[model samples]
Target: MTQNQINQSAWAEKWPAPAKLNLMLRITGQRSDGYHLLQTVFQFIELCDWITFHPVDDGRVSLQKPIPGVPEADDLIIRAAKLLKAETGCEQGVRIEVEKNLPMGGGLGGGSSDAATTLVVLNALWGLQLSMEKLMELGLTLGADVPVFVYGYSSWAEGVGEKLERIDIPEQWFVVIKPNCHVDTKEVFLSKDLTRNSKSIRIADFIAGQHQNDCLGVVRERYQSVKDALVDLSEFSEARLTGTGACVFAQFDSEEAAVSAYRSLQKKWQVYLVKGVNESPLFSKLKSGNIS
Candidate 1:
């Protein structure tokens, strides 16, 4: 079964928010608005976080479990819900349960995806009747990456990651390894040694295999765990950092090949073999009202 299928329940208490990889990232420049100008490809992976929403009568949002360092009230999911409700003037609240599968601060876009999933699911459950564009706008207010999850596709992204162009990425299996550490993204970006001046490159350039994550070098130098994982995964194939990460991945032609590597690394570190997907499974179930 797919990760989404594995994450859902017949008992009615779950939804799926898949993880993402930055196939290629180039920091073209830093915008005056404090956002970095970027060229990157966002690819959806099968590794995901599952969420369940329980509607509450009072206009208050809560989380089932606290995120590591964040309070329930400060959790992005709650913030997303509050923002949506206030914008729509809706008198609804929810208890959001997040089953965390994606590792924290791994540069895998986990929390942002979770927040987006909450927004989308709660919008539907509350009958908010907002267009996807409107939802994306609301999502951007939360975070740049949030809008891409709301759009629900693997894509080419730019401009602090808000601009998106839906693109088809090659279907492959990946052996992703997390070196049991959280690499702070903000630290990577704030480093004076980061390559913020990478030349601009087009989507066609990536299609031709001419782009790479500009943040990789800074991340590797600052985090030994990320460097170690990259080296380990690269022993099997060419491994690449996904965003500014403590996680690194190498693509395989088949699931067996990917899982074979995952098994070997499991004893030594955290590893997963997951398929890459172009479409979000949530779209399928919700679009058809297949909740039953």
Candidate 2:
């Protein structure tokens, strides 16, 4: 169903908003405008926040219920829906129902992914034939990370994460630990100690195991809980902080290894065992739904 053809039956289908991890991030340079240039590898995880749209007779966008501590209008998904409506002048409205499974402030790209999903799915459900490029352009206004999700692929991202080249890496098992704290992304970026300029290396370097996150040091120093989580996760494998994170993860060659680590950590921590993917789950769902 497209546009006016869409009915309440179309609204019954649920859509996925998958989370992403920055496999590696480097601060290549800082722009004169203070926008930090980046060299980052993005990979999606199985974790997702599911969303369902309900038809609203009135031409007003809304959420089923506002997330506590966040106003409905301030929610990224809400903002994304409104953005799409404004861009197309679509008179239709929706009450978005979110099943938020991804932890907030985990540096897992949950919000950006949610926003991207909203943009992509609504464009389809509303029968707005915006080009994927146009949608990605709109997504960038939401966040640097949003474009990657809208692109629906794992990629090597640069230029504050908007520039992307699709790159597929190993889809390994991951044991992720969400530290009992939120690392403020703005604080990490604004810190004087944060690395603003670092030599950028080729994807070959990352493939050959040059996985250094420039913000790791600053984040570790500022959040003791994050530091502790990294230290604990490291015991099982090579631990990495995804973006500026409160969630530290370790990749394992086998699900058994990841399961063992997850089991041990779950006794004392909030953690998840998930698999990595080169493509966003959203794309897979779209394909299966025959809606892409």
Return the top candidate by TM-score: 2
RMSD of each: 4.2, 1.6
- Please give the lDDT score for candidate 1: 0.82
At residue 189, candidate 1 shows an lDDT of 86
Candidate 2: the clashing residue pairs are 3-127
Predicted candidate 1 versus true structure: per-residue lDDT over 205-241, tens digit per residue: 8889875888899889888888888888887778999
Best by lDDT: 2
**Tens digit of lDDT per residue, candidate 2, span 165-244?**
99989999999999989889989999999998899999999999988999999999999999889888899999999999
Superposed by TM-score, candidate 1 places the C-alpha of residue 134 at a distance from the truth, in angstroms, of 1.2
TM-score of 2: 0.97
The whole-model lDDT of each prediction reads 0.82, 0.91
Tell how far residue 245 is off in model 1, in angstroms.
0.7
